[model samples]
Target chain A: MNTFVLLQVSEQVAAKSADMAAKDPHGIIITAVSVSVVFIALIILYFAYTFIGKLTSGQIKMPKIKLPSFKKKTAEVHPTPEEMAAIALALESKRSGEVYAAIGLALHQHMNEKVHDNESYVITIKRRN
Target chain B: MNTIIESLQQFWQYTGFANMTYQHLIMVLIGIAFITVAIKKDWEPLLLVPIGFGMIIGNIPITEGLNVGIYEEGSVLNILYQGVHQGWYPPLIFLGIGAMTDFSALISQPRLMLIGAAAQIGIFGAYALALQLGFNPAEAGAIGIIGGADGPTAIFLSSKLAPHLMGAIAVSAYSYMALVPVIQRPIMLLLTTRKERLIRMKPPRVVSQKEKIIFPVVGFILTAMIVPSGMALLGMLFFGNLLKESGVTKRLAETARGPLIDVVTILIGVTVGCSTQADVFLTGSSVKIFGLGLMSFIIATMCGVLFVKFMNLFCKPENKINPLIGNAGVSAVPDAARVSQNAGREFDKSNHLLMHAMAPNVAGVIGSAVAAGILLSFLG
Candidate 1:
């Protein structure tokens, strides 16, 4: 009897679905059902996440995984006094070269009058002259 | 001389000028206008430029039986268009979206998800309206998804339920998405009082990386269990999110969000635009779809704002939500969220609502996909 009743209910649902499929869909019912289903689904997500949020209110303790360092280790070598002096001279020469190049470019532009004057492009007439 | 004359006539017949119709000219002009707006106005240029160019390509008059048009089975355009028609591009697009999205805001404030669900009233509202206007249920469902403010979701649902209307629905969905700021701002302002706009709730709590990683996996299981039909879109979305959040798959996540999404976007945008051949797109139904789409967008914005106000009634004064951010409940992504920030700044410069608005904005993506799934289950 229980089996029969379950079968009957299943049949009724199938019939109802078929009926809905055959007819022009009842918009009100579709809207209500779709809205309800979407709400129910999202609401479930909301509650689940909310619960999770509460449970995990404190900081999560994740196991630290140590990654291999990619940096290469070089042996520390002390430069002799003469070597250090040579290195310093080379650095000074490079810095002076940059400065000289900039100065030369600026001087060249100035000498050639390549830089624009900041004068306003206004015309004045002198009638008396 | 007679043979030469016949050959000349054949050549003339094959030329575009000989076969040009007013419809083709009109569509071409529309394409040019799209390109102009995208360039001059700088609105959704990524989407509009490709689509506009594709529209011109689609509308160029061609002789029959040449297998050159998008509709021709063996044509290259048609082959590319299969992605759109077969409903695969949307899921791929969703994967990219998932990879790019930061669900921290939504995770921090789960209650805000309701606003996303409420905003979906526009989908059902449009569904009813479309039915009243004589569209069948499946077509109505497809048209209604435009309210979701999600181009890919609309395309996915329409491709499944109403293939014939996919082009019109896609164009309408994208057009309305581009117009979100224009449409949503006025409605947002109209619905909320000045005080409501100025309401500043507490900042969202910081979501831990564990929570972030857990969210996609759990979110997928729960949503999919409830609406298995939405598995295609929802699964891709969550999988993409998982790839991003897992920390172990940085390269994979980067690829999904970057190059993969870009390529899919170009293909989807241009092919969707190409699908709008003048013969298929120019119709009374297309006009009605546009009208319904606008109405749906307005309704969705209104519902989002109103629902926030409703939620505000139960909350304490300090917890009250600013209705301005509610407009972000439609899933237009950072654009809708940006509108909230801009509108809120108009009231209070310090009240930055962009982060808060993103909660509902991302939730709307899930809600719309679920809504699409429901429609598909019922109508597919």
Candidate 2:
């Protein structure tokens, strides 16, 4: 009885092995085909891009555009020495006025105790009762 | 008094305490562990935090017929999960990846693209292993993509080829991606000599803005012509690249890379996590998938490193590549590239490999997608 059971089990095992062997060829074929395809695709890309790299190596320079010149022709002007002196005197007086104005503003703020805060810029009027 | 007691007993029966089992407890504990590791180790916090919390939310036992679970039809989670189920989220994610990625590295040095191709050997290797383990060809193909170390690609491929295994495959791919530093460092060190690690290649040339713009257009045509099955993923990716490189669609590019990707990522991560209810995820097959995933990752790293050493044999001394950067050829984005930089720095502090590694890193993304398309053609 034991021998008979062992024989049956061995036969089943062999059958399973045969079935697996039948499928192995498919696996082998797919593996070979897939690996080859991957290599071929990437190799083609490699060569293609290598060529591209060489072609673009020098950098594709964009054409330089020349803008139309907009030069304005005008005669040169020179001021007389007297006019220059008058201009300098006017500039000096203007600067002194600005300095005085700034000082006056500072003094007014200090006197009103408004140095630390900004003015609200609102005018208030008391209405008659 | 008897009626009140009856009502209390009925209420107790509907509680989570009554419905819970050891499996639920175990799954909850696993969820807690995921959360703790993500917070404590600062590993893949963006992915792990949402996935971890989703795991907790998924495993909470509830009364049957409530239609509240991710697996149940008409549930909110199931609706969100349709993105993963139908494989739309991955293409959208690829769109974002393309918008964010700077292909100057790959364009500057096209030779590195070969390393990406060689690393894909791991996918085939894992497929064969999965077949030996008795999974059907379609299932094995889905499982094998974990070698790509790209979570979206894995999810995309698995959803089409073997929707049953999508959850395990996504989790395994992401887990390995998160452990890139730990898993890759040792292998990278073991595979190369100190001299090879210290060897530095010439800096990549400057890529023109015109070339950058033309790349997506030409790239889309070439790749799509070769593998029309990959049109959805490849098209979206190249389109996103065009938006970024065109300099004319700044708003669209910003949305593609920023808010759009973030929303898709959250949905993908949480839904994938929720799909891992204990009865579904804690299976013998899940364990086998994890084991296969690790082997696939290790094989990819080995192939990448060894291929670089092979490439170095024919190159001039000045142009010889550093073998350390080879590990970046597995498409884990900046993480794998960062690993190469860190490993190279250990040998010679002056040598910087991050910029160089990114060439193969991005190439790996393209290579994996191509491989995925091939598998889909064969299996799907």
Candidate 3:
């Protein structure tokens, strides 16, 4: 309430605020982080572009699985009721024989050599249930 | 005669005849001008027409119905803008916007989607500059909005962060959107070659109905998890796209396109525009905000173009993208696409890159929203 006290309070507030204003903070770390992130992303994208291009262009070869040869029946004979049941049991046990890719490699390789000429093949799309 | 005189005196007192200021009167007129431009000129009518009306209403020192309790404590207009201060309007506007966008163009062209994400450098880069220049984080975020490339996104972000700067930010966003061609052309040209500019892109492989249907559903799962704040925006946007692609929601899609989005846009724009009180509008800080906005937009455009050139170094000629589409990475939507096409036409009239550019243009919408979410998470 006193005049000197009021004046001193105003002076101190002004001095403190001026000092705060003069200090002038910068966002260097934030700016630098964003810029570096953007730069790194661009590099990753460039590599992806080239790496994918190489795969399509035949530069990258994916692993291939081998199929067993189908042998003809060595000795043909008449089957009993027990022989029929044993064969049925073997067929029933083949549950994991599903093809991962429906367009099997044997079919593709055979089509390339014998079925379709050299130019192109018609790929029929099957609707899935 | 005494009664009549008393009544006249009371009217004068109620009308603030003693306190009426010239600047307030000018703001009222400016509001009318804004309304006329929005209605007649169609300069972003969704927001401007409402904003213009709000400005006039707020500056008139009347309309107690808009905010009855605040007439004496502050202007009724200030009280109405409290929703903005509380960070409600921007997210709502964003929700409405997200509900109207279609992201199929982006899903069909995954490589091009990067352009949209790439253009958001304008928002964050401008933010840092504005902050270092003595503005607070909220004000800096508001100024950085000049890079959102989309008017509503810019308006929405700024209104949430710095309601005081809403007027300058809204005006700047719409003005730059109108000038998307002028701002983007030089950078698109300077960054690309004549051969590159004329590069005819292969038509995109047909996007199956199945791919289209699965795109938004899959996108929502990952993006929402990565940036939860983006859920409001990203959710509505993809949800809208789901409606379009699902082949079963014509009625809902029609409503989103017609009444729902339209109503929200008009209310949101005007409410936002009204926040630019004459006193706030006339400040030196608003002028800096405008300048910083312009700078952010320019830098974003150039950054997009330069980023493509950087990406080109590792790409083979067949897979190489046309750098001209780089500007489309900004979120101006079809407007950025038009700019890309116009610049592309300059080299070869037959070169049509607009369809390709749209991928990134729409992506820019997602990118800016994601950036806003990131900023909101850290700063707000």
Candidate 4:
């Protein structure tokens, strides 16, 4: 249950200059800087120890997986079975007299349409000024 | 002409300047010395210089021995000294200090508020010392708060409870701030071992911007819950932080740090300095008061180091604090942090403990102030 609150503020530092006004009341000042040096040394020690322990314990790598590759079709074209069958059927029906004549005429008219599924053989012209 | 000159001569005689004592001259010189330090050494020059100059002005013989001597209440210094008399100077000074201070450091480390709280040991310890030496409770309280290591707090409380002692208290507070490095070092060493001293702490894990912003807000509530009287001191501190962090009050924040604080510092320094005429300042009591303040500072530092040791027994891995930062737990701001950084670098160049030290360094400020506020509330 944290509630938000508004605040106004300030800061004060100068307090006891009179007593602290000495130029080293006790010689050999053990300053804050000196303390920090010791602390840093300790942190390095800890890190070094952790690193050494890990080195002693293990090594690292990733697991392997294998799969096959598919080849490309460079230079090849083949007709569909249905299209070849349709051509054969048209030729067979053309065996007799009138039927053969009619079949030959139909084949001549729809030869491209017999193999193609989606497009038509048509032409258009555009005129420009 | 001849008649007017004769009248002036008689007026000078009556004003009591012709009867001045050697003690008065000594006070003037003392004032000059303070002025010199402020001007030349830059040792808290702003306040010390004015205070010293005020001493010189107030102690100078204002009358030429004519009209009734202006002793007791009629002196010009007496008029200027009224500001100190009314207990107004300290709070105004606090306003200025409040404005100048950056509370973000304290905000980042909420637990550091305790160390700041711990350093106030000087205030109470000094008070008890003064009481043992026979100062009245109010005056002793003033002296004790002197150990909070803050001048304004000392002045504010002294002005309210011990006006006569205001000069001593203010002078002690400001003077001691300059001496913190010297005074604190010995205590830091004596309390902790070299083996203990060399221990390094990890840098604080990332403290988020949101946490920094929320810190003072949370702190105000925490301190207020404990001591309601600390509201003014605590409230003003957090409020200033709110202005800085809220990102909406750019103008107000600028004013607080800039002009608003500067003017008050000048006035407060001179006014407090003026209050100490040689007649009042050069006494056995002032010497004794200074002694008590020094001892109080050492005690505060010792308590801080000891707290580190006390906590080490329970500290878990990765959470262990560098005890050296304990020294920074006193109220000296960047100076204390610098000391911690310098000390850490001594044993290992890679050591950088200042950022961590700041948590408690700034906390010491709040701790001292809260201690003062609590005293001011209960005793005043």
Candidate 4, residue B271: CA error in Å? 0.4
Q: Say which candidate scores most in lDDT.
A: 1
- List runs of model 2 lying over 4 Å from the truth: A1-26, A59-129
Between prediction 2 and prediction 3, the one with superior DockQ is: 2
- List the lowest-lDDT window of 10 residues for candidate 1 chain B: B158-167
Alpha-carbon RMSD, each predicted model: 15.9, 14.3, 11.9, 20.5
Look at candidate 3 and give me any clashing residue pairs.
B47-B269, B50-B270, B51-B270, B98-B236, B98-B237
Which portions of model 3 miss their true places by more than 4 Å? A1-24, A34-129, B16-20, B36-42, B63-100
Q: Can you write out model 1's per-residue Cα lDDT over B1-380, one digit (the tens) per residue?
A: 99999999999999888988998888888889888988998878888888888889988888878888887776898889879877889999999999999999999999999999999999999999998888877778889999999999998988777777888898889888888889999999999998898899799999989999999999999999999999999999999999999997887899999999999999988988887778888999999999999999999999999999999999999888999988998999988999999999999999999999999999999999999999888877
Model 4 agreement with the true structure over B103-134: per-residue lDDT tens digits:
54444334444555455565666666776676
All candidates in order of DockQ, best leading: 1, 2, 3, 4
lDDT, candidate 4, at B171: 85
Alpha carbon lDDT of each predicted model: 0.88, 0.86, 0.66, 0.61
Enumerate clash totals for all models, in the order shown.
Answer: 0, 0, 5, 62
Model 4 / residue B244 / CA error / Å: 1.5
TM-score of chain B of 4: 0.87
- Tell me the deviation in Å of residue B127 in model 1: 0.4
Candidate 2 or 4, higher TM-score? Answer: 2
Question: Chain A alone, model 2, TM-score?
Answer: 0.27
TM-score of each: 0.82, 0.81, 0.71, 0.67
